[model samples]
Target: MSKTTRATQALQQAGVPFTVHAYAYDPNAERIGLQAAEAMGVDPGGVLKTLMVLVDGKPACVVLPSDREVNLKKLAAALGGKTAQMMKPADAERITGYHVGGISPFGQKKRVPTLVEQSAFAHEEVFMNGGQRGLQVKLRPADAVSALGAQVAELI
Candidate 1:
């Protein structure tokens, strides 16, 4: 698979160091993130999933451990919003300029407030979608936080 992607380009532009990894993407998998972790032979917690959400009807991005689930109430509270809900797949794709399974927090068509799970900082590096299916970018969580201007919180 080609290593170049908007996500990778964004990282490069930001001067953030990262490594690109390619894995078999399974569209049929019940859980895409866990499937990625298993394919990469890495801990699930170190594989971050990018989610498109609407906080008070405004687009937002959320990054968290593959093995964890977001608590919408907690997420909304953390963002100082009254409600949070996952964006419809079509809307997510439209907003992020990526397919449902290939959305990455970086290089989205629209820049939105981003929230990253605080627990992700436990790892020296974590993997996230590289703006395409079958591709991942591994980078320091700190770098990602800075690059995305992401708020770190207990979103799980």
Candidate 2:
């Protein structure tokens, strides 16, 4: 079944071509990103996991591949900040208008500064959370950067 989300709506409005993917979410899965990749039959490298982080006390997003973890020091340096840390799940949910396991860089409640890992562009398409659990949005890496107004960095 296909449905719309704030993210999908934004993509459409931006004239960004994309495909919606819906899957049965298994709450028991140990890793949401990996599970999403497995469920969608895509490479983990093509799946981006959006992380909410605080760079020098301000909110920001780091979009990186599911197979990698954000290097906080490097990200902070790239953003010209003294320190960076992951936002708490509750704070992240409250800020992004998305649940912990389904945060997307698009359609966020607040326009937080965002950094997209340069490695994401290595793939033709990226599969990322679609503003909700059990759904993902597929789009070209360039489209994602344009849509999010993100800066490219070596975040991972």
Candidate 3:
């Protein structure tokens, strides 16, 4: 597959330095993020997963470590909303204009409130989906946050 994607294009347009890494994507894998980490021979904590969610019935994007899970109540509070839930897969795909495993916060079809787990900044570099299956981008945490205009919070 071509390494170029909307996500990559967005990053480039923003002038954020990043490196793309391609790996074998297993659609059947139990956990897509972990699979990417293992395929790239990196720590799961350094591989972030992009998730679409509904906070107070509004679309939002969240990026967190592969080894962690989002606490709905915490996420809700972080977003200053009363409730939060995982967006339906079909809804997520429709709103983001990318498949579940390929969604990236940078280049979604719609701009929404986005958050990156504060802890992720602990890592010098992190990997996230590159708007395509089997593709990921490695970049500085601060760069990703700035590129997406995402708030850093305790999302996990």
Candidate 4:
């Protein structure tokens, strides 16, 4: 069998329902989540951004509200680690098998720990990068946690 892209293969195997939204890609963009929200005409707050962080020397995924920044102190406390810091871009790409702007919490090269902001659980559905830039996947936050085996925590 041939391997499919991370977004498609992971969602299909997990049986998680999701909708894909595609938009024009911009290479010079800074905040990918904001750009995606604007392109999709959705509130930026409803879109989530996936970040790679090193917790106790291990890479982990941290999902947070697009409108808010990750609180490293809180994330450290949640993970029971003394400190947490953003991973290097190259390291993130190598571990996630996706570029910086396209990293998703769903499928990764390695099954690193994942933590999502508790606030996201309040929304009925949320949008996140679909393992690629200019593409997003819409699904329930609960399903995301289930599919990724992520823990719910106050990451932002």
lDDT (Cα) of model 2: 0.91
Worst 10 residues of 1 by lDDT: 1-10
Give candidate 2's error at residue 108 in angstroms: 0.4
For candidate 3, lDDT tens digit of each residue in 15-70?
Answer: 99999999999999989999999999999999999989999999999999999999
> How many residue pairs clash in all the candidates, one count each?
0, 0, 0, 0
Please, what are the lDDT tens digits per residue for candidate 2 over residues 52-152? Answer: 99999999999999999999999999989999999999999999998888788889999988999999999999998898899999999999999998999
lDDT of prediction 4: 0.86
Give per-residue CA lDDT, model 1, range 1-156, as digits (tens).
779988899999999999999999999998889999999999999999999999999999999999999999999999999999999999999999999889999999999999999999999999999999989999999999999999999998
Question: How high a TM-score does candidate 1 get?
Answer: 0.98
| Candidate 4 TM-score versus the reference | 0.94
Better of 1 and 4 by TM-score: 1
What are the per-model C-alpha RMSD values against the true structure? Answer: 0.6, 1.1, 0.6, 2.5
Writing each residue's lDDT as its tens digit, candidate 4 over 1-156 gives: 112459657988999998887777577878888888888898888899999999878788999888889999899888889899999999999999998888888778888889999999778999988888788888999999899888999877
Model 1 regions lying over 4 Å from their true place: none
Give, for candidate 4, the lowest lDDT window spanning 10 residues. 1-10
Candidate 1 residue pairs that clash: none
